[model samples]
Target chain A: MMNQTKFEELCASFALGALDDNEKQELLRELEESRPEQLETLKSYMDTAEHLPAGVEQTDPPEHIRAAIFKEIGAAPATEQQQDEATPPRQIAPPAWIRAAAVFLAAVCLVLLYFTLNLNSERIELAETVEQQRFEILDLRDRVQVAERYLEIIGSRNTYLVSMDGLEPSPSGFGRVFYDPESRAAILQVANLPASPPDKDYQLWVIREGTPVSAGLFSLDVDDQKRYFVLEDFFEEDFEGVDAVAITLEPEGGVPQPTGDMFLLGSPS
Target chain B: MFILFALLKKLTGDAQEEAELLIAVAGKDQQALGRLYDLYKRLLFSLCVSILKDRHEAEELLQEIFVQVWQKAAAYNPEKGTAYTWLVSLTRNRAIDRIRSKSWKNQQITDSDPDNKILELIPTEGSNPLHVTVAKQRSTMIQQFLNKIPDEQRSVLTAAYFEGFSQSEIADQTGLPLGTVKSRMRQGLLKLKEMLSGKEDQI
Candidate 1:
């Protein structure tokens, strides 16, 4: 029994989602008897209510929601028209040979891709193997040269053998140096030495009158057979100026002066 | 500007289009339904999210709303209101029902909103890209209108509209008498109607 203005007011709240449930039911009952003008007013109020949330950020539903909605209603999407037009019923099925050709092409492509991939990996592995063998060959040639040099230094008439004994740092370590004063070439042969830490290398230092000069660095890894290290450009000074040859664990590359614990020291026998 | 004009023209004709679209939907014209969805998805979705405050729940409710629209498209009476009004009513009722019945407020959008296989919603109008722009425009107008309303009245309307509070609940929340809440709500809504009327005439 609501008056026209009261009913309209309640309809406005109803549109705004503020109407009580009981009052909503009452509104509906009034709705059945409303004239067109009244309903039009109600509609405008509802539309106004709809717009009231300009403050609430408007968000588009996820696109998948569109697909989901179409799926739920069993309706084709708007894009279906073009898709339908593009695909005629009669042309839906391509020629059987075309299908076979497509399948064959796909299979051929897959096989080619598989073989190409396999061949590419094999080529890389082969290159790596060749590279490894090239390095090994270079290393073998260098070893042969060192052995020849060691022999030449050992057999030289002016060659002198210096017996080296282990220091406190490596009591069990011992080594020998053969120097040919004429060629100023030297070779070191050592054994029973602890492995070098990754950050440290064994450096050979030649000390003369308390002034030590760096000989060179050598790594001790693998078997004892390849223990000989040829000292390149052995010394800038004459052999007579050399007082002693000592090996120490220095930084990766040898330093001009010995700063680490001496592992071995050698002088004239 | 041209796009805005096109949308306005489209919205102007929306009364008939919406009715026709619903009729087609009743006849199970899915394309028609899709057209309708394209038109109002943003507006209705914004309303749903505004009420539900949970995007997931809003999305689920949007699906249910569309499904309900499909099932009841035939029952739609154009004489009662525009198609927009009908869609809004459905969205509002369902969202409010969820917030109230499921204790959506108390339950924490744990969103135990059971995965009911609900049907979809949307419209059968043709492509209209400006629907989003149109929603934004209408929202801007509403904001201006609300700002123009007195603070007390605007507050009551906002609480009632967004919070879905009843007059008595609003009275309690605002610490105002029930009679005062009712008066504020009526006056605010009357102002809204009047403002909208002036806008439509301008258009």
Candidate 2:
């Protein structure tokens, strides 16, 4: 039973992520009951953490990430075109046939140029130049697409869905983990789990016997279908434990090692 | 004497004008982009290093971020934030994304084999420092402030700031819970902000 000031102090702890689960739940409950002022302050404070590293500014994004974004964009135009077909054509848009004609003309010109320029040359040199130019065009087109899509993905920061296969127990069982490393958070979306008794909850372990750490307690939804569990704690080093990792039915919060019946197992490998 | 004073003011005005000019280049002007690169490369590189923690990765990320600015200049909304703020966010997000990715994480721990040659090829921090306007003295002050935090907090803060972890990631690495990690980071930052603000007063 913490008071308002204590709860506020704990909010600072919550914002810093220093609070344990019980403490965290308590603070969250308090936040729910308390005035909006505390919540606002907490949100602003947390948001600032995102920008506090402002003293350091990246001069640029990696060429690879840019390339990946471009690739995503480049692949999207066809999808966009299909979607656009369902609607009435806009007045400002270029006619599809005209655009197609232009593309055909460009291709013809490219073929002619290819033949004329390579008339006296060996096949290899001519092929290399054309391939290089083709890649360059492809890359440029991809970049244009990324520019269009950037705004849409901007709000969905720091979330990733990674699929993993079961390493043992039910090796066939597959699952996805929605991870946000920025928040040091992950949510397991287990497709299936072995049935366990009421006395035991499925304890999630990061894996590796001595190194295996407790992630948290979890159970499948009423359908015994998908289970969602929050990542409790982990280390970059704990990734070694990732292989052949198994979930087992245990008491709450999970035991240090696998003590009960194996429920689900997964390996990133 | 009056003319000299006015001339100095005008020169200062030109610096602001110069920044605007660079921003425009970043928008659609290639030469302007080159000039902006000339002006800010070193500072940006250092910032990237401070966060990316890997020189090669930072270098690559830096190039990509700039190209993005060039392509997306039309999308740049001046009202939302400064170019500097936008660029910082862009770079940080990419770096953090890389750091947290399973591929990158696996590479970091497993690829213990040192790239001695690559390490040598990469510019040492001070050796080829960018010629940006970030005063060495101010940078030193900031560095000192960084030193004041406990090593554990500093590690997590550095990881979060540069590598782009949410509160949860910090907790994961430090064996703390999501809530605790967020609180620690907020408290840590509040302290640094106060300290830096106080330092400004003293100055």
Q: By DockQ, who's the top model here?
A: 1
TM-score of each: 0.46, 0.37
The sequence of per-residue lDDT tens digits that candidate 1 reaches over residues A1-269 is 67876776676676565656566666766766666566656655555565565546678888777778777877665453543454354236788899999999999999999999999999999999999999999999999999899899999998878878889987888999998888888888998788887788999888888788887888776433227778757886777867888989998876767889998998865
Q: Estimate, for each residue in B1-203, the C-alpha lDDT of model 2 and write its tens digit.
A: 56545644554444444446446754555444544454445556676677667788777766766666666666545443344444555555566566666443343312222222212222222210111122223445566677787766666666656555545666777788765655556556666656654664221
Candidate 2: stretches off by over 4 Å: A1-269, B1-23, B102-137, B201-203
Encode model 2's per-residue lDDT on A38-123: one tens digit a residue.
65555444433433443453344333443343343342222223324522243246889999999999999999999977884767
Model 2: fraction of the reference interface contacts it also forms = 0.10
Query: What's the DockQ for every one of the candidates?
Result: 0.18, 0.04
Q: Say which candidate scores most in lDDT.
A: 1
True lDDT of residue B139, candidate 1:
66
C-alpha positional error of residue B153 in candidate 2 after TM-score superposition, expressed in Å: 3.1
Residue A128 in model 2: lDDT: 90
